[model samples]
Each structure stands twice: as structure tokens, then as C-alpha cells.
Target: MKKLKILILLLTAAISVSAQGFEHFVTAKGNQLMDGDEPMRFFSWNIPNLNYVEDEMEFGRTNPYDLPTEFEMRDAFETVKRMGGTVIRIYTIPVRNTDFPEDAVTFVEAPGEFNEEAFKVNDMMLALANEYEIRIIFSLLNNWPWMGGRPNYAAFRGKDKDEFWTDKQLIKDFKKTVEFTVNRTNTITGVKYKDDKSILCWETGNELESPYSWTKEIAAYVKRLDKNHLFMDGFFAIDGRTTVMRESLADPNIDIVSSHHYEPNPIKMMKHIDNNLRVVKGQKPYIVGEFGFASTKGMEAVMQKIMAEKDIVGGLTWSIRYHHRDGGFYHHSEPLGNGIYKSFHYPGFHSGLVYDEKDFLDMYRRYAFEIRGMEAGVDEAPNAPKLLEIVESHDIRWQGSAGASGYHVQRSESAEGPWEVIGYNVSDAAIQTFANFHDESAELGKSYYYQVLATNQGGESEPSNVVGPVVYEYQALVDNWVNYGKAFDSKDIELVTGDDRSFKEITSRAKGKKGSEMLYHVEGELVGFKVYAFEENPDTSSLKIEISGDGERWNEADTQTEVYASKEKNYAYQVPKFYQVSEGENIRYIRISFQDVAQIARVELLYK
Candidate 1:
């Protein structure tokens, strides 16, 4: 059997090398990770790796750590395959032996102490990977919870960063574990499984180096043991200096440069990838080891853009286990316990291909197949227009999917290249279009660009083509006052301060329709008081101001604050600190009587 396995590996190696056609690793001059071969996208449904298999037992008697029966493993594997997934990343490294009477067993490969039960679990996972003919990236170490196969060991927990870097024994055990897995083949199942390409890659750890590292010992160890298989030293682009992470990958031992891409801003991710690519000396394949669309601001659009680029070999979203009731990744919903980790459904992994409860899979099934080297359909983009134009006051709009939450509309003077975004606006369902502005700031005569994007519950749509004559002029300043008018006074009631003692003490029963006085609480360390008014009136350049601290001490009539009334329609007044009340003083009413009649609407008080 060993001899037969050797022969198969030799043949497979020859085929793989020859089929590559191009260089072995990514190069700097051309595209990085991707080359002649069609890029392959990988997806992983990571189990948080905190709950031990023993803890997950149906009954205490039956050892749950044993490998899932072949039937069960196949069922799980086939589900992912059906969902159009090409790979799976599992967190199966065991952390403890509860039966041990001494200190909890911490090492993944303790000297002579081997856990057959734990091995069985991993064996099933690998066997299933082969059976389904899907690639697998076995993460060598799970996150903080189950570090190096120890249950709840503080040394491995996320917060205990010091030990993982400093502990000599822990480092030794980690190296041994990788050595054991890469060297030992699974023959216990009597399956003809050997080192197959289906076992695509091995990851050092998931989201490692976030807390910072004192040593590169773990990476060094993997390089020494598995020279044949590629090493994906994990990185989370969220916290680390991306340049540093890319530099770490430059080590001769590291075969693939891997990083996790999770940013709300699409442009940020673009800049990040570009920056990291700068120092990666020669050409080396870079992988966004994991990324996802759940709560990940612009995931879908970003992924679509990145994947379309021929340079990016392939990338993986968070997971395939859409129904991990036990939870997974940065965000996880409920899990489906029906003997399967359902991908689609409420509360499951939001990043699954199939809905856990419903059979609905993403329409991008064709895209998935394409990544795996299958013939695919021509890019069938919907007939959404490339550009849209609207008058200055009107909104630019469009209808799109339920997954779109909002769109970004960018504008530029030139129709050809660089564009600056005026603002990112929301999709107003009431208007039936994703709307945005080229407001009063928009210039007339000059062609200004306009675009609309549909946004949904999941993500945003691509921007539309630039549109516009998109005129912007003062929309007939007809009753410009009425246009921006607001009133704070009424004929029926008058705002008054009964006495001078009422200074700064706003009293109710003094004012407009309901006679409800709006009081300003000058509490705490407040410095001063300010009142704002909005109006859109014409022919008014000056206004008479009235002041009454406590309504009784009327300072007659004064022209304190003035306005050119410009073409805009807002006015403000700062009630002087001299009019301010002490802790014991009772200050009140303030009234503004315009000497030149102008329209006024809405009023506000601001702290200075």
C-alpha cells in the first residue's frame, strides 16, 4: 500500500507541476498570487474550537471524540459540495483528557501520551475531505479557547498572550503536533488516502498575531517539518501593521502570504492589499485567507471586485457552516443540530452558500464553479444603466436588490477618470430609489456627474455610470423666506418673563400655540446660551432684536445681531453671558421681533 501511494504521489506531482505552466510562486512584476491556472476560491466553516468533543457528547458513556462514522462525514462533506463550496477548514485539534488526575493536559502532542480518541475525530474529517474530493485547509491551532489541544487552559486563551510567545514547552509541543500530522498518514480507515492535493494547505493558526508575538518559533517549526506542503502563516489585517505581516511571509520557509481582509471600507482594503504587496520581494502568492460579508461593511462588492482581478489567485469568505448553532467566526448565528451544520437559515453562519432552513443558494453558483476551474457563464450583469442625471434640487435614484443597504455616488468634473464622492446616502424605500445629492453646492452650466446605487440588508450595489447636465441654480428664490421659513411667535400668546428675577429662567405658559415655553437648561459647566433660526425670506437685510432676562428686565429694543441674509436662510443669536443667570438667579424669556419682516421657521439652542 505504501509503495502504491508513493507511485500515485509521483504521478500527481508531475501533473501538477506541468499543469501549472507558469512560475511556481507569485511574482512581483506581473500578477502576485494568480498565474496561468484559474484561481480557486476556498471557504471555511470554522467551529469556534472552544467546546471539546467530550463536552459535546450525547451521552457520557459513548466517547464522542471518535471519528464521525464514514456515513456522517460524507453527509457533511457533500452538503458543502452541493452548496458550490470548494474547500473546508475545520478546528478539530483536541485540547484535553478530562480523565487525567494531574494538571490538565496542555500539549497537542504530549511526549508519549497520545489520544486515540482525538486522532479518530481528525481522521474522519480528513477522510471525508478526500471522499468529497474537496480541498481542505486544516488550521494547526484553533483560537484562544482550545490552544494546542488544551481545554480552557489560560495559557492558550486569547487574553493570555504572554505565554504563547514565551513558553518553551508549549512551542515544542506545537511543532511536534504539525510533525505528527504531516508525517503520519491515515491508514486506520483502510482507505487509499495518501498525501493528496485535496488536502490543499495547512494553516499555522487562525487570526494569530493579533495580540503581537515575541517569536517566530511556530512558523519556523512548520517550515522544518513540511517542506512539501505549503505553509499559510495566519494574519488578521484588522490590527497588525500589514507591512510587518507581509514581511513575516517573506521568510524563506513561508510558502504563501496569507492575511484576513475584514474592513467596512472597500477602498481601505484595496489600499491595504496594495501596500502589503509593495515589500513582498519577489513574486509570492498572497491569499485573503478568510473574509466574509456578515457585518463586514462592503464584503460582497469588495469580494466581487477582488475576484474579478486576474491577479488574486483565490480567497475564502468566513465559512460554509451556515447553521453552526454553536457559533463561528467574528459573527455567528444559531447552529443547526440536525446532524449537519446547515449553511443557510436564521441564526446560522451568515456567510454560508445555502440558507440553513430554505434551499435557497446564492445566484452566484456559476461564479463559484468558475473559480474551481469549471466552465462558467458570461458575466451577466443586470441591465442597470451606467449613468444618471438630475436637476440640482432633485434626487438621483434607482431600485435594486433587498441585500443592498446603501450606495455610494461619486462625482468629478471630468467624465473620464478621477471622481470625488460628495457623500454616501441611504436608500429611501419611500422614494423607490437609492438617492443622493448634487445640492446647492452643485454648479450650473458645468457638467457635474451623478450616479445611483442600490443598497440592501447585506451590502451595497456597484455605482452607476456618471450622469448630469445636472444643473444647480438657486431654485427660484421666490419667497425664499417662505422657502426656508420658521416661526417661534404667535398672535394668540406672547413670550414674557413676569419679572427681571426670572432672568435665564425660561418659564412655561409663555409663547406660541400651546403657550409651552422651551427652556434651556444651563446646568453643569455650561459656558453660554445660543439660539438659532432658519428662514427663507426675500428683501430683508436687517432685523430688530428684543432681549428680556427674566422677561421683566427688557433691554428695550436693540440691533445686536445682524445678517446679510445672504442667499442662504439661517440666523443665530448668542444670549450674552451678561444676561446669564447665577445659581440663584431666575432668568427667563427672550424674543426676537424682526424690524424688517422676514420668514422664520424652527429654532434651536446650542451650548457654547
Candidate 2:
């Protein structure tokens, strides 16, 4: 027993050291690869591990019992090949043991047994990849709702199960999993799989950084694994520049920079792209690993323009499976079922490329098909906006719409690049009227570029002037606030006046919920105060409030006045109401709250 234990320990140590020694280098042609080869542009389906198999099985009509079967993988790979896809992305972390209860492999700890079912499935997948000439980008770490450990006795965990950055048990489980994958040569029908040219890359994790710390540990660990495949990590570029990219690239183990872009406007999406490119500075290769096109307008043209550029490798849309839980919209082919695929419960997410009998291939053809390549270089010159045209300005607005939601304008002096967020349409003027804003502060004699984007109910509109880069130097920062999700409730307005004694900043309270209130602090003199309520909707019924001076002497705003509907027939009240100052003037503190019990929508404030 002691000799056997020593052998196992030595083997484990050998695996860890083997994983850490490899270094990544670029090919002469500038493609980012593990062994310095061109990455074959491919499309892949993200198959969840044993734990998530049930969700996919039940909702997506996949049969996990036959998952490792040769015929099943061959059929799946063939289908993908028919759709022009060249790769498959398989998940390694199983979410819940229940997702595959009948299966022999389990992440849960039982005794001294090991469940090698995951390894078996992976072997089948690799065989399929070899058969179909499709590459595989396997994710190593456990993702989302699953914890990791041993077989029948593994430590299965997710982000919530353990602190992603500091969980020791989870880390150890991952290290073991990697060792198992690297040391074991996969077998499909008695054939060994290793050092195969068909395996494209080894991805570190899928969609990491819900808070941004997971990447550091996971990236480092992956570097300690097999050196044969290029290491990639997934990231979402939502706000700010690529702060996360800078941190990830600092570790030498990371081979290529990858990110997901989903902005409404082509120009806006390009902003993220440009920002990422600037940070990378071409030291390594970069790719927009994941980007999506809703049945919308902007991205098609944007993609067409990008297809003409050489630096970009390619991007994977969302999921490749024609399943319902993921809103199965078929991009490359038509749906196989008629009334066969329908959401049994929540139906809001319709993100699939093919939907019931519909031939949605045109959508894919419109963007991905006709793409060609061109050299990459920026020309620095007139830094001003061109074709600065407004597509559609609307009187009404809603969240996530092209003409209805919001607008954004950007300016850059170099024209070659480095565009800055000059202004956004969230300003009081832009919200009220979709008008052009001219930044008089723009310095003369220097070139500038500018572009305007409109967002309405569907999403942001395609940026108007995408043909040429726009230039602008003069700009201003607009001050405004918006209702984030829901209208303010009565409890939110009335609860504040009771006993709180400090001059509290109301921004935190108003966050997430929508309503209007005075933004500037009223610090000086106060002879009278009024709450301006806008009767924007008909459902509003009541209002609530609280007042305080010196953080004491709390008095509630008149509940009667707050409860009244709009002076108009609608429940909303846009007019302001005057309230007499109960204290002897020189009011240093004022807190008035308003909530519409009936159908509160928009509110404002008027004070003197």
C-alpha cells in the first residue's frame, strides 16, 4: 500500500509540473495558437457537464444515456459540419449530480471509488472531432451552479458554493481534474486520443468573472496543465475599458485575448473592440470569441464591415444546439420540429437561430457568409465625425429599444483611434427631444470624430455613419438621472422621513427603481418646497413621504397630498405642489418623499 501510494503521489506531481512548463508563441503569419498554427474558424455547442445534462436533456431533447455512443457523436458532428461549423465546445464541470443521477460518474463524495464517466464522454467527443475534422476547445474548470471534487465523492461546487477566488477545496479538485485529463490518453472504440491535430484549444473557463477574481487563479492553474493546446479565457466587455484583459494578459500562460461583445450599435461594439485592441497592442492575437446578432439591423452591417478587416479571427454566436431553453433560433439551418419545440414554462427568451419550421438560414448568410479579408492599419487625420446623420429620434422611449431607449455620441482627436465617450443621450435634453448636441468646447484646428446612436424598445439602432470614422474635439458631460428598472413604490418614498438624522444622499435609494427628484443639493435658503409628480401612467394611486431637519424632528409628508391622483384624469400628476415650511426658515435640511400607490411612473421636484 505504501509503495502504491508513493507511485500515485509521484505521478500527480509529474502531471502538475508538466502542465506548467510550456510557453506560447505566435506563428510567422500572426495567428494565435498552442503549437503556433492558424486557428480554423469554427462554431461549437457548449455542452454542460454531467450535472447540467438533465437541463439539456429535458429541455433540449438530448439523451445523455447515449451521449458517449459513437453514433450519437458522429451524427452531432455531421450536423455541425453541415452548418459550416468546425469545432465543438464541451463543458467539463458538472453542475448537480442529479443532472446525471442514473450515470455512474458523480461529483459527490461517496467512498474510495472514482467515476470516470466524464472522461468517457470526453473521449467520445474527441473521437467525433477526429471523425468530422472539427476541433475541440475544452473548458477545464467547473462553471456556474456546480461544485467540483471527487467521483461519487468529488467536491462538486459553483460560485455560490464556494468563494471563487479563495476556495481551497475547489482549487484542489480542479487541479486533480486537470491532471486526470492531461495524463490519460482518451480512448474511443479502442483508439487512443492524444497530440491529435483535431483538438484546437484548451479554454481556461467559460464566462468567468461575475466579480472578476476567478480569472487570476483559473488562468494560472491552466498554465500548469497540458501545453499542446492554446489557453483561452472568456470575458464579457460590458462597461469601461479592458481592465480585466490587462490583468489576465499579465500572466504569461494566457496565449490569446478573447472577449464577448453585445452592444446594440455597431460603432458602440467597435468601441469595445478598439479599446481591447489598444490594450493588447498586438503582443498577442485577439478575437471577439463570442458576439450575437438578434433578429435586428445594426450588427449585420457592422459584421460586414469587420469581415473586411484582417486582424479579427472570428466569433461564435451563442449556442449551436437547436434547443428551447436557450431560445432556439436557428442561424445556419431550419428547425427540425414544427410544434415540436416550444417552451413549457417561461417564454421570454427566444434567442435561437431557427424557430419551429422557419428557414432562418438567411440571417446567417447575411452576416457570416460573405466575409472577406483586408489589411489592418489606422490613418491619423481629420478627427471629426463624417455622415453624422440621425437615423430616428422618437418622442417616446422604452428600455433596450433603438429609437426609444437612449443615444450615445463619441469623439476622438487622433482620428486614427482613441475615441472617448463625449456624451450620451441620457441627458435631459436628449431624453425630452432627440436633438443634436454640439460641444462648443471642442478645440479648433484639431481634427475630431463623432457618431450618434439611438436606442429604443428593440435595442440601440445601428450607428448612422459607420462608413468612415467621425471626428470631434468639442464635447460636454451631460448631467441626468434615469429610473433603472421599476417605478418608485410608496414604501421607498415614505419610509425615509421617520427617524434618520443625517443629510443622506438620495441617489442610493433611487437606484434600480425609477422616479424624478431634485439632483442638486439644496444647501442655502428655503422659503417653500414642492414635490413635482408626473402623471405618466394611469395605475398610480398613492404617495408617501418623510421630512427631517438636523437629522431629527422627523415629519412625514402629507399622506393625503401624496395619495391624490394626477390633477388630470390620469393617475399621474406632472404639476408641482407647494408645501409651507413648518420650521422658521433657514432650512439646512429637507427630505420630501413621494410614491404613487395607484400607478407611479415619473416624478420631479420644484424648490425655492
Instruction: Assess every candidate by TM-score.
Output: 0.45, 0.45
**Residues forming the 10-long window of minimal summed lDDT in candidate 1:** 500-509
Worst 10 residues of 2 by lDDT: 498-507
Model 2 agreement with the true structure over 320-437: per-residue lDDT tens digits = 4321211111112112112122211101122222231122333333344333122212111111122334221111122121012235555566544465665565421112112234
Q: lDDT of each structure?
A: 0.42, 0.40
lDDT of 1 by residue, 1-608 (tens): 99999999898667544433223232222234322254445433433322222212111111222233343344345545654566666654555433332333333434335565556556666655655666666676655443333222324334254465556665555555667766665544332222444455676666665333422566666656655455665654541255436456546655566666555456777666566556454356666665543332354455565566554555665443221121111112222212222223211222232333222234344445656666534322222223334653434443332223245566777666477766564422211011223243454456666665544333455667667545553221101111122233334334432221111111111222322232223222222223322223323422333444454465533333323222111112112111122122232334544433222222322111
How far in Å is the alpha carbon of 183 misplaced in model 2? 2.1
Q: Top model by lDDT, which number?
A: 1
Off by over 4 Å in 2: 1-52, 55-69, 95-114, 146-162, 189-194, 210-221, 235-244, 264-267, 322-360, 363-608
